[model samples]
Target: MVKVATYFAMTFGAFLFWQSMDRVHVWIALHQDEKKERMEREQEIKRMQAELMAQAKESES
Candidate 1:
């Protein structure tokens, strides 16, 4: 009876640990995706600014 109870407790602990690790992995992946999106947005904004500057220079000429 004692062995059975010990096994049950260990199994429950392992299950909880696995669940928490899964959440951590998901959170890391989401942050990485967000970072990638932010970089792309910054690049796009820079490109637009360059285009606007070119237009202004052309208008000055």
Candidate 2:
């Protein structure tokens, strides 16, 4: 009976550990995706600003 209980405890602990690890992986993935999106947005903003500057110089001439 004690052996059976020990086996169950071990299995339960493994299951819990696996679930936590899965959650950590998901969080990391989401954080990376957000970082990528932010960088893209920054690039776009820089591009637009450069375009505006070019147009202004052309109009002045």
Candidate 3:
């Protein structure tokens, strides 16, 4: 009975450890995705700014 109890405890510990790692992995994935989206938004903003500048220059000339 003691050995069975020990085995159960070790298995539970391992399960908890694996679950924590899974959470970490999910968080990292979400962070990376957000970073990628932010970069894309920045690029769009830059493109829009350039277009506006060009329009202004044309109007001045």
Model 1, range 1-61, lDDT digits (tens) per residue?
9999999999999999999999999999999999999999999999999999999999999
Off by over 4 Å in 1: none
Candidate number that wins on TM-score, 1 or 3: 3
Rank ordering of all candidates by TM-score, starting from the highest: 2, 3, 1
Runs of candidate 3 with Cα error greater than 4 angstroms are none
Clashing pairs in 2: none
Structural RMSD, model 1:
1.0
lDDT of 3 by residue, 8-61 (tens): 999999999999999999999999999999999999999999999999999999
Model 3: worst 10 consecutive residues (lDDT sum): 1-10
> TM-scores of all models?
0.89, 0.93, 0.91
lDDT values of the candidates?
Answer: 1.00, 1.00, 1.00
Candidate 2 wrongly placed segments (more than 4 Å):
none
Model 3 has a clash total of 0
